[model samples]
Target chain A: MALTLDQRSASRRESRRPAGPRPVRGGQSPLARRQRRIFGPFLAIPLALYLVLFIGPTLYSIYAAFTNWDGINTPTWRGTDNFTALFDDPLFIESFWNTLLILVVVGIGIFVLAFSFMLLLRDMKGKGFVRGVIFLPHIVSPIVLAIFWGFLLRHDGLLNALIVKFGGEPVAWIGPDSAFLMIMIAMVWISTGFYVAILMAGVDRIPGYFYEDASLAGASAWQKLRHITLPLSWDVIGVAAVLWTISSVKVFEFIYAFGASQGQMPPAYEWNAAVFVYGVTFGGATPQYRFGYACASALVMLLLVTGMVALLRRAMRRDAVQF
Target chain B: MTRTGRLRRSISFAALGLSALLAVSACGSPSGPGDSAASGEFTYWSMWQEKEPQAQVIKAAIDSFTKDTGIKVDVQWHGREVMKKLTPSLRTKAAADLVDQSMNQLGNGLSNTGQSADLTSVYNLEVPGEGKKVSDVIPSKYVDYLKDKEGKPFMVPYEVTGEGLWFNAKQLPTEQPQTWDDLVKLLDAAKAKGVSPLALDADNTGVAKYWPLLTLIRAVGPEGMQKLASDRTGAAWDDPNVLDAVTRVEKLVKGGYFAPGYNSGQYPAQQNLWAQNKAAYILQGSWVTSETKTYAAQGFEYSSVQLPPINGGTDAVGVNFFGFGIPKTAANGEAAGKFIAYFLNKSRLEGISTKADNITPRADIPAPAALESLSKSFQEKAVYPSGAALGLKFGGWESTAFQPVAQSLVQGKTSAADFVSQVKAKSIEFWKTQG
Candidate 1:
């Protein structure tokens, strides 16, 4: 596979030809400068495409929020009316609180579970199979997962059938006990696989000597995990957490798929920030489309996500412990 | 510089110019989909998929209209994105000539936002063949529907259906309970038999608990309920009749009338139990028969009974119907109006009964075998404008009144009297905000 062309002498000529390593500035090379200037704008193609296609419509929709446009009528300026109403609206508040709670509780729970699994499976048999099995839900579409889950969670769905047979009462997976918990359960179940994979990848990278040396020094398994494994994997943990916070805030499909359980969205156990914005802005029930309020909700979610990632990153701060 | 350097510069300049031009073109067009119907096609959009049987029936209506008018209807069968995808055109008033939507939800959706046109004048249409007026063809079927008190028909009912409770006869019995006592007694019997008395998903909080709450309210007196909704203030979760309803529901829950884990149970299990011989009753509409036909295949015998009152709702259940209306943005209001009148005709409504397994609201239209017997019973006994009329058609009562009341009942939290109070409070609040 080796090409024997220049060896060391040809490289020296090429290096010397670059005008003693200075950039091809306008002073040095007019042609090179012209080429650089001309090619610069052409590189903006991808960004230009992204801005127009995704960001443009999104911005337009955000703008439409300030007005009362019901899909058919001309947008009438409502100013802060949508936001004012959203503040007073009990439903939005309920959803916001519930979503925030789910993010914190479920987020931590799934991470802990995945990390534990990473430790347990390290020296265990069938490690690859176990990892693959756990990650399967992460690979499946959220919509499909939610639909199937509805059957298990709905009042009369599979859960009730089993409960009735087992002399137990059925639980309302969609509605009463807590829609957030239901959503959290599904989210954790679905997301654990992804976190497990990340943790496992991190675990796999740990140097063998660190563990071998620890064992030779008679360091207990628990002490090695706490002192070495935990410290070494903090970088990966931080990255995983950054992913979780970013993803958790924008969650919609899983919650939506778990259907409102008949108006349990936002105001009841089922609602959160995303669902609140959804029902407020482009919902079927609300005659008044509060596009602006929805934008505000989205803005709030973005801030919360940013704040969380920053806080988590800061909290997980430690010097890199290279082996 | 050298000639070769100048030539390389020229080549580079040309390539760079070409790339910039390409990048500029690659920038988003900032325009939506093309107006496919601008090619002289009468575009009709409906909530239909190709595989649906209902699509075929609706297609027949479109086909019939095309045959009679010599117009080509380009119908786009959209399932979901029709609202989001078609929103731009709908807002810009470049919507379809005829759009398919349910009267209540879509009415509140499109027309409530002031998109659709009032069909009052259209109802004053002439008959297609007999030189008779359209009123003569369909009679007063849609006349009352085409206008609000302000004389604006925001949305019109396309299909007619009656709202009531549906139950499996094996558990609920064919002889529909006439009195509220009778209804409770039946539940008691089912409860004693170790079956769920009612198939109520409290979590849904929209229909199940609310129906009984309304039934109890009507029993106490519609006037008081109406006055309470108009009279009360915040959190009227403590009205006497409403309390009674709540107490009764709580009793039902404590007495094991509702399924255990009822809070978390799926809705279908309640009715499914009836199919599986586990449930006794479910509050539903006539559409349940058509909607639950598959139950028959699953060895379940399902039938519907009117929403009986606490003491035989002297007035009746409620009056909600599927409606038809022309969009204010219709390209040809005249043609669209003609289609509405033509299709909702006696023959057409009757034709719908033959095709789609639903009850026709037309007094003259004959019912099919499935609906024939029930239709006779409804005409003979079921009171009019009670069940469907209970909702706020012009005002906003559907979300506030019925759903909340039902949710309370399912949760076993509010009494019937309290439910009524809640309804009253919601009604008043709705009226205050209502335009």
Candidate 2:
């Protein structure tokens, strides 16, 4: 009777267990518990620290926008005057329009290339090598990257040598007419690797079984990609767009590095909003140091980015399409 | 987290916070401005930018001053971005006693902030460099930049510079251009040979890049460039001589004698044209020697000739001062004055000139062998200050306005007359606020 009871207990345990699913943690917290845990001190400290460091300074900067502090003295209130000047300042307008154009044109151009490369990433030969080369620009310091690019693109630089080899005159890569374009190309080259890697990660997350099942259903490669890859990477693409938008708006190191080194300020196209602000503040013999003006410009940019982030989040919001 | 872990993290964070706070406090600490020389400890700030050796030479000179007089100069060597930092400080009264002359900064920056000391007394006082004593050493043409509007002395002269026609002798046809026409002929030669033409950094540097214009105006005598600076609509642009000078720069660019891309830089724009040998001939300054000897990658036998007279323009180089001034509040003002006097003395000036590779502004100190030789013939033949050149004050914004308009001229989008007229109109507009 005892032996029978022991065998019965073993059989009961076996019956309770289930199969045909991926492994996961058996012990889990309830919704109420998990939500509360996130607010616990361990998480709160780090979250608060980030909020204070990045967000606090940003908020403070916004407040300072309407003030006339020369960076040395305490700030004094001045209403929308700085903003008013920024709009009328012809150079500021040119800089603003130019930067916007760059953000859109280069951002779109790079995204297409970056996404295509991401879809091509699977089973690609020498994938690590390819990724490393593409990603190097994003990893290096902007100063080093800018200096190298400047050397490559100067009139007597290596690019001219290549142009000569191709039977064309040594065109000034940083000339007034072409400076903005070369800058765009360089920026895209530097930034796309990052966007591509992110999209690739999204592509990697889409279960292979989905593609396998689609293939079994006689789906073509194009059909599989259209169905699975695009939908899966949409969120990542949105994020890349938002990031590149902000980055391209305030592009500085490149413009400064590549400004026609000797002559006229590299024809006006290179003057983005940041360059314009800098030129106004510090370009001449005695900097006007219009702190209020600069702060207002920054606030405009900050508000622009904030609005975009909110908009992007809204646009990207959809039921997480579970397969 | 365990109690131990929590304790450790807190301790570490507290330590970091304390360290950061300490760093900030330390950075904020400064000796209050009330040191009235009672302690005799003073900080001497120098706005010099050069390589390590030159800085060391300056340090040695300071040490010599300290040894000769019991006063000290705690020299803080600021680099090239001196104006960016120095200007704000001066506006706020946090400035050093002495500053150097930047390309655009002379007097306007100080006056603009309404903080310029009453320097009238300093100006009227007899300067160390004057007449035969200092004039002989410095190129006489440079004296005008140092003179105030009322012909009173303002900036104390340091290094003298002159704009000359430079060429990569190696790329040239074994002959020096004797006049402005001869140089143009060389550019024509290079274009004919299918090589790069005479390089001109016709980029954006005013007065410097427009050497032909300024020289032509100066050569045209007192009524030339100055009249243009003050006159709207370039009343003088049609002066037959002015037209010739305008045509010279345009002619060179159109002739394709310049490198593939010239007339596109900001400060010292014409420099790159000569440095790269993209243009075979560059009409630039004696400072080219400094640029060439320092950055050897610029590749060339950088040599200069007095810019040839244009049609009948003066065959002369425009020279200017890299000046120094002693602020009255100098903690060691007496010693500072002594140092300034010694620095201007031919012996000490020669010491610095040798190290700086600059032509001494004082007539007493001779230029080093190489510079002396290059400047010799021209120093004999050059014209002094042209009455027509726009008298530049610090904070002058022509640099910003003139560049685009001038570039438009180079591109043939604007006429030389328009550029000249625009300059005059802009000058008037700028002066209105300060007038």
Candidate 3:
């Protein structure tokens, strides 16, 4: 019966194809000619725009990285000086370290929390409502979240006020030693929800019969999750990991808005690679306008992220588990 | 034809129409050098927002200039980020004929880049209906202080801002301290009375640097501060005077003189605390008076004193000027110059003091009540433009090297000696990258 149904659907798909002039061997079909005529103009505009707006600047930035361009001034070739100087820059080094810390540390915190929530919600009543609640923070603007986070953690802010009210001494939650940690925590909190949703969608696709069968065979919840759920959701998890790898590197505005004071960038200790680029080029009371140097740092970040994503893809690759 | 096919064709046509509309509209705006000039309209990009008091005063002056000279002016209130926006426009014909910003910003963005026009002619241009030339009414010292790298005047002064120890007269009416020791004594007395001696928004590196920079400027002279900032080897930080300044900062930190959590909270937090009488003093710019006005304690009377002299150091006050400059490529440079001269007229310039609560370069105009003491200091003391300007010349030295070290010292995270060492190390590291 399934074979007959497959053949019927295949015949229907075959019927949907345009009945047009047959292709002259080694030549052309009328449909191909017509498709080219219709879509060629459509494709050309965006392709041209993409080249001009995106690819052109990308290529220019790669070139700019080797020069001493100050945006307005004509660029002069400095060879590898900008790239070499980056290693000597304490700010760039600290920012590079901070960016890596966020990617690995905050990245782990997000995935672990997301997976746990995905499991917890699978059996919970009103799981949709609970999921929606968990996802709320993802929708709010990061700037607004940063402000709210500041008010909660700042000295004499709400949390401190509450502590003082309870006869406890106020603590500097966002002090120099702890500000970056607080930022990382806020990042994890903000990010876990989106990952949970991605993960939940992946978990939802598993057939219920596998869990039922495992249960009848006296399989435990952990066993079912480990054996069935994780394997089924592996591809989605891989995609989510890649998504996070890219997004984490791009985390700028939250830290920028949170740590900033009087329109100046946050202190150097709190900066990530993204903020480092902005600080050197166009940020602060007087912009440094080191376009070439900024581009070099940016290129470094780009290469590192690309290499990391590639490694991640290799690590996550596995044979698909078809049920 | 299939409905879907027909729909797809219509969608493509709509997209094509949209792109055509966008392309046409993009070309419709008047941009390019000489366009406004040929139309006989002067274009100005102001550094003040339209709603700001400074802009209101300038807007009135622009209106009067147009009325008196019959020259139409097109103004865009680009606010504080005007320099960032104006830089790209400099290479294009779209650049404003006139722009205004702090001297340091102009130095970094335009004058240093040779984008500013020499405004010596404008300075000599006579004020409309006033016999005095623009240079005669405004002090030459200001002109000299804000001159371009080539020692040519590029910007005309309108508003003057200076940094000092701000206090509320209603709360602490003590006489101004003359020496660093006396200042410390005053802070101790204020602390003994259960008031936080100082308010520091240490998170704001710009404001946080004030304590160290002021101390350094007072210990060594402005030139000394400039030398340390511009030092490529970073060995200048090892100077005894730099140590003295850092030591004073350490003393303040160890004494617990700063408001609680000063290093943790963002700006305006500690400043607001100072306004509420949670702290007795705050080292800030002249603008602090107006900025904290709304949040001030009832019966608050804003007052300030010049940073006290340290170890018989020169009594030079640090002043920053906000002013106007005509770009080199300006088409309507003559008209812009006339407007600048007209704006300097005492009757028009007084609005900067009266309405804006700021000190104008015109010494004849009485300063606003809050800034009276700062204005007096500027007149009586030997003035040096803020070290911030010199710091910028060294390429990110202020933000990247000095600010972080200063922050560490003020935050009590490092000792004075450690601070100096760290600064020396960071400065050397910073200058290495400048190559």
Tens-place lDDT per residue, model 3, A1-323, is 44455467657766765668744522557777777767967998999899989999999999999999877778899999998888988788889999999999999999999989988999899999988888898999999999999999998799999999999988989888999999999999999999999999999999889989999999998898899999999999999999999999999989988998666789878999999998888788777788899999999999999999999999999999987
Chain B TM-score (each prediction, in order): 0.74, 0.72, 0.89
Highest lDDT among the candidates is held by which one?
3
Specify the poorest-scoring 10-residue window by lDDT in model 1 chain A.
A260-269
| Candidates 1 onward: DockQ, in order | 0.29, 0.13, 0.34
User: Candidate 2 residues B254-322, lDDT tens each?
Assistant: 555555556433334346545655456655557667765644334456566665555565555555555
Q: TM-scores of all models? A: 0.79, 0.72, 0.91
Point out the higher-scoring one by lDDT: 1 or 2: 1
Restricting to chain A, the TM-score for each candidate equals 0.80, 0.77, 0.90
Where does model 1 sit among the CAPRI classes?
acceptable
**What lDDT score is found at residue A191 in candidate 2?**
87
lDDT, candidate 1, residue B430? 53
Q: Of models 1 and 3, which has the larger lDDT?
A: 3
